[model samples]
Target chain A: MTTITVATRPTEAPAGHRLRFMFADMITVTWRNLLALTRIPEALFFTTLQPIMFVLLFRYVFGGAIPIPGGIPYVDYMMPGIFVQAVMFGAVGTSVGLAEDLQKGLIERFRALPMARSAVLAGRTTADAVRNVFVVLIMTGVAFAVGFRINTTVVDYVLGAALLVAFAYSMSWGFAAIGLAAPNSETAQVMAFPILIPLTFASTAFVPIQALPGWLQVFARHQPVSVVINGARSLMVGGYYHSTSSLWYALLWIAALLIVLVPLGVWRYRKTS
Target chain B: MGANSSIAVDAHDLVKVFPRGHVRALDGVSLEVEAGTILGLLGPNGAGKTTAVRILSTIIGPDSGHATILGHDVVKEADTVRRIIGLAGQNAAVDDYLTGRENIRMVGRLSHMSWKSVGARADELLETFGLTDAGNRVLKTYSGGMRRRLDLAAALVAQPPILFLDEPTTGLDPQSRQDLWRVIEGLVAEGTTVLLTTQYLEEADRLARDIVVIDHGRVIAQGTPAQLKADLGTSVVSVTLADAGTAQRAAVLLAPLSAQPPLVEGATVDLTVDDGPKVAVEVLRSLDSAALSLAGLALREPSLDDVFLTLTGHKAEVANDGGTPA
Candidate 1:
């Protein structure tokens, strides 16, 4: 038999080219995740439906009962919070996706490849950010149908949506770490809900911080969710509720989360066995 | 390129102990695979076969010792090793949400193939693997064998010279297993070096040029299939008695017939001998004169099964406390 030559040479490129390859690898992984999301219609259906249900529950069920501090319309007061809540909930997909990949040995396959080590986590979070945008747009439409209006300029409204997505993207990194830590998708879901529940409900996402008991009010006002919700409220409504400080605090919270969770998620990804 | 390197895979005294369960998965295990040949890592469940593969593939590092693929360190030079090696683990790692073609292409892209070649290579692999018709269908709709085929195709997308197959056909049906064996043989003919771990003796005998028999994370025997069988003897004289007690007595009676002692397993006694027909006559006459009632008797060539039973004192499928299953 004729002997064939082995391809054992290292395929290392220049440092600049490697960086570009890393970005391309991340995009490829992101595209793969989005393609998977499209195939699972039920998952996307439930993700979109949950936010719409939250909008209706707060708009009609509790809108009349909870009076705003400044006599603002409850729909306007709650819509910004609803947008934040929707993206936060949508970010859970990042955890579930990563856990599933880990459980199914897809992560092992990716690890064996010559791709960038950070590509898997970065790609997953970016894909969830894209999904958050879609879910946020759908929630906005539902909010509009249910008597929610943007009192600010169209540019400010766009900025508000962008802020919500940024927050969602940062949360995706946090959830990505959880997903890597959990053994399976079910465990990831169970672990994520406990953290998400108090952060979204105990904050100003649905109810006014002043209406909460005094003991809970301090936490309800200062949490990241509340800060981002209030910032989105200022950007979208811009009345007595508007404050430049709220927007700055929201940006700072997003920056802090990214700074802490990005490396944490990548570290978790590498450490996952 | 190290294309002419004699030893495609060189591992030395590799040791690994998992923190969970404190399982010593690999205990001073070491083996080498020559270029352009297949080496079968033969073992039962939890014999550190998967652990060895994981370490060689650079998925995890050994607690001690070291391995190199074509002179590139598996741990320190992992990125370089990754460029030349492909791993298809026990589980089919292809995504259920993507099509067969799409899965191959995605792996190609991750392996750093140019976009132009990734698409063409994916299509070429799908066709070669007989998945061209089902290439467009999502993997959720594929059968177990199809998924296994696609998983292997994905691994080969970058044309890696060295391949690690960790029980690639463990759960496949008989026909699918044969099909995979044929594909593997074809690949080996083209000079792709393979390190295949298997619990199936027949699979190792059929595919590997050399086999390393491991038990409890240690190599007990290593040789070609023919040589291993020859070491047991030329032929085996098997006799089925009425009960376990009678079989034990018959083993003592027939122990002098062969150089090695008879192996008694419940109601059957097996004795390896140099001559088949001559040994068969002697065995029957001795048992008859001893008044031992024989249910059946047969003489056949010594298979790897006999070699394994002689060396390990147990069947290949019997699990021992070596480590967790892969």
Candidate 2:
């Protein structure tokens, strides 16, 4: 019989110590995923490339065809909307990443480890949130280059950027649910696009509420995406539509998205193999 | 070797009915691995081997019954169980985008090791798995064998007392499989209890101390590899008859000398008998006396294939270097 070697086996850490490790482990998972982003330049290139193309298409192609109220530059009005759309697209990456992990059996390995169960979702969402922040900063630079100037103070701009990032963070939880539900990365993209496309296009992100047909205008005005867009626009441009309630509505939608999607995502993650 | 030795891995009556198509992947399966010993769960594909490993490792919950690793319950004390057990699943779980070293370090950090220790351990494992040269290369650039080795290294980052390897060499070439087998042997020598699942009988024969043959979601036989092979107790005599009409009469003529009832397939009759050559000669003479011509006749030593054929009424799905039964 082989002699037992106490030194070879890992002793269990105490409960209190393990709780601290959970956060640390979550950060490690997040860092690993971010490192993956650096390695996959193609995915990042395509992701950012699509949004930049949208900005150029709307600026040169559609800008001449449309006019905003109060003689405001369309560039000024559309920048915030572009930022909102860019962050929303960034959130879809969370689901695709998570689904890809599941398909590759990486999640099964993680689940088998003693790390915090929340770390998988936490790390994925956090990584995607950081990516959203990066995307927003880059889009902001592009907007400026194309003559999109902020009419508000520096504090308002920072807060608007922060709000956009927070909204993307909230959206990550929803997409995390989709990722856990999808069987593979391709399926995750297919599943996300339908929901995301409608939520983004039917809102005021690209066009004013008046430009849409009356039936679509109702959706464009009241949707969460529209609320976030309005909140961001008012914060950046500071106009008649800039009300404190717009930010409150965006925050409320964020709270609702988290309260519902976080638990659903965690539940689905627990149920997956 | 004694009965008082601690059970490192204990599972009782595990049942898993998958939601999709309601396939009953596992039904009432149970086994035990004594401390510092290996238990090979051997079976054909879709025989509930992966399901059992997943349930034991807490990836999926069993429909009923329970399991424990290193005295911690797999379900109730899963966190503790996770702390003590390491698992390398069917698919290599290393991140394709990360370097081999980074993948190991990632798992080490997730296991709650300090950053310094994570780096140290990653280097140690990279050396041990012969991955030092490729340590800085991303996994997508690594060979299939290297990826699997890195995955196994990831599982060992914490040096858990018990390890589960689910078909570690499933898709590997023969040379890679041998390299992995050596690494596993090294780990076992360091006093780790292992539960390995594989379709290769030769793998179980080489590595397992005790073997459990499972089929159709249940354990069909259990013993040491030698014991399982020895229980067959005789060779198989297969006789191909020239007179198809006389095959049944030939089987009746050989019944008393055969250990089991003769099995007839097409024009051939297979009999399990002691003293295979003598039995083959006697059967040939008897069939000739009965005016039944013989097309071909042979007596062969029993192999694991015969053992599988006897237990499951079919051959194992894997292609293995067939070893003659002793």
Measured by TM-score, the strongest candidate is 1
Alpha carbon lDDT of each predicted model: 0.88, 0.85
lDDT of 2: 0.85
DockQ of 1: 0.50
Q: What share of the true interface contacts does candidate 1 keep?
A: 0.59
**Which residue pairs come into collision in candidate 1?**
none
CA deviation > 4 Å runs, candidate 2: A1-10, B1-5, B236-257, B260-271, B283-301, B319-326
lDDT of 2 by residue, B265-303 (tens): 678787877688888788877877888888888888666
> How many clashes does each candidate structure show, in the order listed?
0, 0
Candidate 1: which stretches are off by over 4 Å?
A1-16, B1-4, B243-249, B256-261, B318-326
Docking class of 2: medium
